[model samples]
Target: MRAPTPVSASLDDLEPGDQALVAEVSPPHELSAWTAWLTSLGFEPGEPVRLLSRARPGGDPLCVRVGGSTYALRRAEAACIRVWREVARR
Candidate 1:
């Protein structure tokens, strides 16, 4: 049988204190410019990332830590980064 595909989640989908690995930084075609900026901010594949916190009310600005630096990103911007959550082994 074929192996099951791994479930991927967007960075915006993670809750505060949650950790995940960067899988991709692909913004939609309309926002192609975001790709370079996001990568320059250290949101590269295989880099470890964590969700620090989110603003109250609308939660538009999400605080995330990637590499040694932290950045604040919009919910829509965060959605561009795809991540793979680690599953705990039994």
Candidate 2:
């Protein structure tokens, strides 16, 4: 059987209304608090995180949905997250 195509993407690259699986999460810098904080928010590998909305004009704070909860995250914070699975063309 053919294996599923492996794809990688940064969370911030996702357009509005996109959904992806959290493949990895890295902090902005070594020993950054984001590493621990993200984990607490269930931002772990294989977790389903969907981009719900973004701030107008410039996308800064993003609205994301994880599992059943939604979170408002900064663009920089989202950039630290990597996602897998090829997003279907919209």
Top candidate when judged by TM-score against the true structure: 1
So what's the TM-score on candidate 1? 0.88
Which segments of candidate 2 are over 4 A away from where they belong?
1-4, 88-90
* Candidate 1, 24-49: lDDT as tens digits: 99899999999999999999999999
lDDT of each: 0.93, 0.84
How many clashes (backbone atoms < 3 Å, residues ≥3 apart in a chain or on different chains) does model 1 have?
Answer: 0
Q: Compared with the true structure, what per-residue lDDT tens digits does model 2 show for residues 2-79?
A: 555657898888888877899988866764898789878989999988899999879889998888889999988899
lDDT of 2 at 21: 95
Estimated TM-score for each candidate? 0.88, 0.84
Instruction: Flag clash pairs in model 1.
Output: none
